[model samples]
Target: MLHAFLAAAIPNPGPEAPPGLGDLTNTILAWIKWGCLVSGVAGLMICGGMMILGRRNRNQLAIEGVSSTVWVFGGLALVATAAGLVSVVV
Candidate 1:
C-alpha cells in the first residue's frame, strides 16, 4: 500500500516545517529526536571505551549500561516515529 502511494505521487521532500511547541506530538518529537541523537553518541563513546574501562570494572555492568542507553534511545525514536505517523494520517 505504502509502496503504491510513493509510486503514484512524485516525491517532494520540500522544506520541512519549522519546529515549535504547538502540540504534544511536536514537543515529544523534538525531545525524541534530540534524546536519540545524544544517547546514540554517548552509547558509542561508552561502548568504545568499554574495552579498556571494563578491565578495571565489571564488563557486564558496562555492557548493561550501554544496552540500557540503546533501549532508551530506541524508545524515544519510536515515539517520534509514531507521532509523525499520526500527523501524516490525520
Candidate 2:
C-alpha cells in the first residue's frame, strides 16, 4: 500500500544530540535555564517594588506592574515545562 511504502521511506531514529557536541549543548542549556530562573526572581522583585511605589498616586504604574507580573509568571511556567513539552512532541 502507499501508506506502508511511505512509512518505510522515512526513518525515525528518535531525538539525539550531535555526537561531539552533547556536553557543550547541555552546558549551554543549563546556563540558559539558570539565567531564566535568576531573571524570573528579579522580575518578581522589581514588579513588587513597582506595585508598592505606585500604590500611593501612580495608579497606572500599579496596573502595569500587575499586568507584567502575569507575563513573568507565564515565562517561568514555560521554562519549567519546556523539557516535558519537548519530550511529548518528539
Task: Using TM-score, give the best candidate's number.
Answer: 2
- Name the lDDT value of residue 56 in candidate 2: 83
lDDT of 1 at 77: 65
Candidate 2: C-alpha lDDT:
0.94
**Poorest stretch of ten by lDDT in candidate 2:** 10-19
List model 2 lDDT by residue over 1-90, tens digit each.
999999999997987888999999999999999999999999999999889989988988888889999999999999999999999998
- Clash tally for model 1: 0
Q: Which residue runs of candidate 1 sit more than 4 Å off their true CA positions?
A: 1-32, 69-73, 85-90
| Residue clash pairs of candidate 2 | none
lDDT of 1 by residue, 1-90 (tens): 998998789776644555763576677777867877777677766665764466565887667666666675776567558757766875
Q: RMSD per prediction, one decimal?
A: 8.2, 1.8
Per-candidate TM equals 0.37, 0.85
User: Pick by lDDT: which candidate is best?
Assistant: 2
lDDT (C-alpha, whole model) for all candidates:
0.68, 0.94
| Candidate 2 TM-score, C-alpha based | 0.85
Worst 10-residue stretch by lDDT in candidate 1? 13-22
